[model samples]
Every structure is written in C-alpha cells, then in structure tokens.
Target: MSVIGQAEGIEHGTVRGYKQHRYRQIPACDACKKALRDDRAAARRGERPERAKPQRTSRRKAAEELDAATEATPVLLPVPPPPQLPDRPEIGVPIEGADLEIGDVIVFLGNHHRIDRFEPYTGSLRAELGEGTRVACAGTWGMTVGPTSTVRILPRPRRDAR
Candidate 1:
C-alpha cells in the first residue's frame, strides 16, 4: 500500500504494524509532511508562524494631511540673542609666587622692559628698559621685584597703544 493510505489503513484497523514503532518513522502524506517540516523549522529558528499584517493608509494621502496641518500652524518668532559679556579690566597682574621667564615684559619705576635673562643663583633679573639702559633688579626670587617696588609683568600693552 502507498504511504498516503497508511494513516487511513491504521485508522480503519486494516493494517498490521509492528508492536514497537517510533511515530517519527511513520511516513506521512506530502501535505502533512510539509506542515510538520514547517512547524519544526519554526521551532528550531525560535519563531512562530506570523499572521497577516493589517492594511495601512496610502502614503500619498498621509503626507498630504501632514503638510496641510503644518501649513495651518502659526509661525514662531526667532529666539532672542544671549546677554552681552562684561568688559574686563585694562591693567592688572599678580606678582606674588610667580615664575619669571625670558622675554617677559615688566613695568618698573615708570618704565617697561623686556626681561633678557634670569639669574636664580644671585636672585636678580637683567632687563633692558630702552637703549643705553640695561640694569639688574634684585629680589627676583618668586618673581617679586621688591618690597617697595610696584613692578608687575604685563601680558600685553593696551590695544589703543598700538
């Protein structure tokens, strides 16, 4: 008998089969075998048979509605500019506990000079105020000019000076 008729034959009690039989060993018809295989594949892939998705509105109609809604909305005003920053001081420099370097400009005795060199061993700095005037200022340690001296290192002159 054909395999397709085996299930019918078993159901009708007309076929004599072995007493010990594995269900997997039983041959199935084409359609039943296809369904069993599909179910097993879905299980192995960690998925279930999905149902058909619901229909959605047309893309053109949805886009037209969105455009109409946006056009009907009011136009928003531009954001205001941020607050202005405060102006900084013209002249201010800290002299205490500072490290002096070559090319540093210092205001001393109503004159400005570029530092030519620093003598740490003698605690002095050599600078040129202008032509024909190069002097050694004492107490250069920690960049302190002197107890009475108001000398300070200027980062740069005022922009108006240029």
Candidate 2:
C-alpha cells in the first residue's frame, strides 16, 4: 500500500482510483504485515523490545582460508615450445631485394628487434600483427619451387590485384 507523490509522497488519488477499479488491489509484503501485527501486539502489552545484534566471525581464520584456497590453485600457465623454420637452403636464404608477398613464410634473419616469427606474406603486404609476436612456417620449399610458388603460398588467400 506504499505510494509516491502526496503529503507523505504517496499518490493518494491514484491509490483510491486503483482500489475502486480492482476488487482485490494494493498488494502488501507479508513481512511488513507481520511487523505491523507485532507492533500492535507490543503496543497492547505496553512493552518495546531492543533490536538484535549481528554475530561476528574471526578475521584471522577467514584470512587463513583465503590463503589456503589461493595456494591450492596455479596462477601462471606453462610456456610453449618455439616455432620451427623450414630446413631447405634455397627457400631459407634471405632474398636481398625481394619484398615478402602474402603467403610467403620467411624467417627473420636480420638483427633488428630480434624476434623469431615466420613472416607469412599475404597479397595485402600489410601485416596487422602486434609487435614482438613470433610465428613459424609449416610448408617446406622444394628445389623447383620458388618463394612465390603455389606449393608454398596456396594455403592462404591472396589479395586481388588492383
């Protein structure tokens, strides 16, 4: 039966209208009704009871339990093995002037920033990879196949020529 927007901030007219329209309206909580009944009973007896205090748990025991739980579980994961490069000499050799295409898995040999990721060349040429990420090429190079051969580059999609 609690309302809003009146002298007590409850909409009195709306409450009255709702009560008139509905046969069984204005639903109230059981605990609130029980509290009202208890108040009435206490008033009739002319006795008021003090509120009950909450129980406290040991902080040291709680801390010990939390520490035991944290110790039981592992926080860090196991590190994985590094990526492997192709064994062939021709494909493994770094080309002086040749820019890597999409699908070309090149092992970085230069000492600049020193990371061991296989640089897969795509048609787009622009690699949207984060810095310092290491990758390995799965395909091996044959004597007949060059760096841009279908055997080595056919696994991934290539960008359309402009």
Candidate 3:
C-alpha cells in the first residue's frame, strides 16, 4: 500500500487487527505538514511568504566618511596644561603625649586628619581624615589613637584648593 495516500480504490485497510485510515486522516508526512503550516501562515499574513533579505553595510564607505569628517573639523585652540596643586602646610601631632581638642587639624603619615572627639577616660581620640585618604596605622576608630601615634598638623588648604 502507498504510504502517502490510499492505494487505488481502497479507502481503508486492517493490519494486525488494527484499522488503517487514509493517509490524509490518519497520518501526513513532514513535507505536507510544513506546506499546510506555511499556507495557513501566509493566509493570516494576507500575502505570499518570502524569504528575508540580508542586511548589508559598506564598512569602507563608513570609514571614509568618518575620516572626511575628522579632516573637515578644525582644531581651534591647544588644550591648556592642568593647574598645579598648592603646597600643603607642614603640621604634626604626636599622639604619644600631645594635647588634642575637637576641630583640631593634624597630618598623620602625610594624610590630613581633624580631631572630631576626645575621650579623656580612655585616652582615645576620634579624628576624621579627608575622604579617600589612606593611612598605615590601625585601630583609628575606638580606643585607636595611642601616645605612640604621631600625627602632623596639616596646614590650612589655600582658598584656591577648595
């Protein structure tokens, strides 16, 4: 029997005690199914389906245009050099035996710090340094400052430095 359709005038058959319907009803091949799907899709889209066109661009033309634009633009002025940083003042504070008060500025290990609070009982001083400042000493938080710690008093920043 033909696998694709009913053989001759035969509409159905029985094989192994099982009834076999026509190919259209019982089974359709891959090609038939794909064609039916494409027809339906085209009907829904209201047009014959066509393959997509490849998108293409000319790299050489684009590069030439960019080069032309770069050449056409004029350089009006040379860029100025960056301004120099003002000289910092020399200030020091020896944590070992130095009197400290709130709002006092000191430099520690080349970084500037301001004493924000002092605990007489614990002999701990809380100081705030410039944001992003890095220091080598540890325990700068609570009970951190010790007599052995030497801090330099930072010079006031020039008005321009602000």
Candidate 4:
C-alpha cells in the first residue's frame, strides 16, 4: 500500500482490500480530514520544520581586548600598617610567653612600667612598684635579666604609635 493511502487509511480506517463495515465509513469532520491530508502531503514533499537560529558572541575576545587596553595603565593601592600590642597593664589578663622580664623598666606607650618581680610558675609579675598588676609580656623572665636588656613598654611613649 502507498504511504499516503496507508496514513489516510489509519486516520479514517478505510483499507483498500478490507470488506466494508459500519465503522470504516464513519465520516470524519472536514477540518480533521483536511489536516491529515496536509500532513501526509508535507511528508511526501520532504519539507523540514524550521529550526531556531544560533546566538553569536565574542565575549572572551572582548575581555582580552579590554585587558590589553588597560595593560599599560598603572594602579595604586594603599599599604596596611603592622599590628601593634596594647600598652599598660591589667589584672586577670594573661599575656603569651612574656615580652618583659623582671627588673625591666618598660616605658608603655602611654605610661612607664618596671617589672620588679615576675614568677613564671604562677604567671604573675610586679610592675611600676605593683601599680601595674599581673603585667603580661611575650617571653620568659629570669633573674639578672633586666629591662635594660629587653624591650621597654611606655604608654604613648612618643607622639606616634598612639
């Protein structure tokens, strides 16, 4: 059987060699019949459905161009200052290791302090004649090692580093 006829036969159920039956001739509505015929004709003519067009882009090339455009331009950024420790002393405040030692006269940035006594086993220190309580420093303190040999602490020692 021809393809178009077979297709039409499937839609309307009218086979060429089959005996007539009440169901075979059940008339199809005009619109349905015409649509099936059009589809079959289109299939025979080999007409393809239209496809969506592809998009074009030069983003990467544009970015490279931009980079090249700015390649010769110089950029300036600010540098950050170094971290600093606080001056003076307080009680119940633990300092790592100890930056000060007993007998060390430290001029804190804002005030002056001298560690007259420091006990490593108990992590306690006496500074400023005990005015500064439990002073914290960064290294271990030992006897005979005085402030003259180590860094000093002075609160607001100079106009800078305040």
Candidate 5:
C-alpha cells in the first residue's frame, strides 16, 4: 500500500520486479498480481515453469530487537591508552675513540629522543634528552633515581655499530 512502489511510469509487473517489491516490504502492484495469477494458471496447464516462492525471514524483528537492546544499554568499555615503545637494552657502546655514549635512538617513558653527546657528573652520566629536559644517568654503569624519573646504563654493553 506504500506510494513508493506505485510510480506512475515505472513497470513493476514481472516476477523479478514483484520479488524486489517484497524485499523492500512493499505491496505488489495490481499488474504484478495479475501476472503472478496468469503464470500460476499456465503452470497448472503445463504451459510454463513453476514460479519459485520468495524466501521469508524474521530479520526485521531481530534487527528491531537489537536496536532496542542497544538503546536501553549503553557501551561503557574504557578506551585503552596508546602503545608505548619498548626500552632499548643497550643504548650505546664504547667506540675506540669515544667514551661510553648512547645510541642514535633512545626510547624513554614511551618516547624517543636523539643523543649526540654525553654530560658526565661524578658517579653518573647526564644526557640532555630534549630541548629543556636534562635527564641524568646512563645504563648499568650507574643509575640515578630521583623523585620524578630513573635512568640506568648497562655496565658492559656489546660494542655495536650505532
């Protein structure tokens, strides 16, 4: 009975067209109904192939129930934080002409920073991590633990080409 299936100039009289109408939950037009009746009559007289019955399902009801359940119960899952980069076991190695230094790349507290130089102080080493941040301590040689952060350097890291 919907006006959508009753376009003035559109043809909806074929079996294919009627099936499409049923798919959209639209009522078949009078022309399509007459075509179906004539086809059945011909099949009874053995004049044509029998028409196939359209498949029926309760998908609409299930979809409606799903919509209602989602509306009644909101999703309360927490969003996980972004992944952090794993720390490097050996930040640097001792080159023939250089003191123990850091690698080209260093990951700290889930962040990466470049280290081109070293600033040593007594029992520990200091590396100016970024613009205004000066974090002290290198691998296992000694670690500097403060109220804010901790840095450690491995005593004997393999000499690698960094």
Candidate 6:
C-alpha cells in the first residue's frame, strides 16, 4: 500500500495531512504517522530541522541569541491554590478477629453463621445457622495457617465484598 496517498491532494505524508485523514475517517498511512512522530520529536527539542537554518553561529552570537530569547519570554500569572475538599468519614468498619461477641452473625464457608458460644481466650466460636445445623470454629478465622486468616468475624463479610 502507498504510504503517501494523493487521493484528494491532502498531502498525506505530513502531520497536518494525518489529521485530515482522521477527519475524513480514513486510516493514516505509515509515512503520515512517521511524519507526525518526527514533528512531535522536533517540537520537544525546540528545533525545526525542515525550516531554513542560519548555518553558522559564533559562541558570542549564540549567547546573545540565548539572552534575547530569554527576554522574549511571556510573563506568567500567579495561579490560585486548589479548593479544599470536605472531610469524609471512613468507609467500612474494621473488624477485630477474636473480639467477636456471642450471637454475633459471622460469615463462614460463604454462609451466615450466628455465633452461639464464643471463647475470648481461645478465639473459638460456635455458630448456628438454623434449628439443627451448627458450625464449631476452632478460631475466629474461617481458615487459618501460620497466623494468617482468610475470613473476618463479621456477618456476611462476603456480601460487603460484592
């Protein structure tokens, strides 16, 4: 495919031509993309290589030019400070793993379990779901290994996650 297309005399090898292609819903060619990239690279370096250059400059002349350029800079206005945002309350409440009280509903095995008997010292709890089904947890955590826990001692912790 021709990278520099000449369908409508749009000059498709340049950055301006690339924008024209986009405005007309046409995919820009590789040459146009390369041209755009080169243009941006030149802009970052503050240079226009395609434009005519003075060809030579002495150190003193270059210093004078630099001083002139600095003097030509526009005056900057003072910017106001950012607006202060209103203070917000913290999101979800933090759950203490072993500090859960009896009759407190807890989520275990993705099910709601109301604690029946809880041992504060052992961090153990017995939760009952219904009339007969009961879950005796050895620790406050649903799954524990090396002081790491997978569950929080809260009623429907999984629900809050969703």
C-alpha lDDT values of all predictions: 0.41, 0.35, 0.41, 0.38, 0.44, 0.47
When summed lDDT is taken over every stretch of 10 residues in candidate 2, the lowest stretch is 149-158
Candidate 3 local lDDT, 1-162, one digit each (tens): 354334333222222111122221233233443454566587689785344455465999878876887889764443432343332335342222233445556665565656665554322233442222222322373224433343444433334442
Which pairs clash (backbone N, Cα, C closer than 3 Å) in model 6? none
Best by TM-score: 6
Per-residue alpha-carbon lDDT of candidate 1 for residues 32-101, written as tens digits (9 for 90 to 100):
5345446658869978534445557699988987798788876554444334333222232323213344
Candidate 4 per-residue lDDT, tens place, 28-70, comes to 3334434544755885887634344454649998788668868
Best by lDDT: 6
Q: What's the TM-score of each model vs. the native?
A: 0.23, 0.16, 0.23, 0.18, 0.24, 0.26
* Winner of 2 and 6 under TM-score: 6
What value does the lDDT take at residue 152 in candidate 3? 44
Error of 2 at 87 (Å): 94
Error of 4 at 145 (Å): 3.5
Model 5 error, position 137 (Å): 82
RMSD of each: 38.9, 31.7, 36.6, 41.0, 31.1, 23.2
Query: Rank by TM-score, descending?
Result: 6, 5, 1, 3, 4, 2
Worst 10 residues of 5 by lDDT: 92-101
lDDT of 6 by residue, 56-154 (tens): 899999999879978897645444323433312121122334344455555554555556563323323323222222233444543221111122344
Residue 105, candidate 2: alpha-carbon lDDT: 45
Error of 5 at 158 (Å): 92
In model 2, which runs have C-alpha deviations exceeding 4 angstroms?
1-25, 48-162
Per-residue C-alpha lDDT of model 2 across residues 127-161, encoded as one tens digit per residue = 33322222333344211222322222111122442
Evaluation by TM-score, superior candidate among 4 and 6:
6
Deviation in angstroms for 89 in model 4? 11
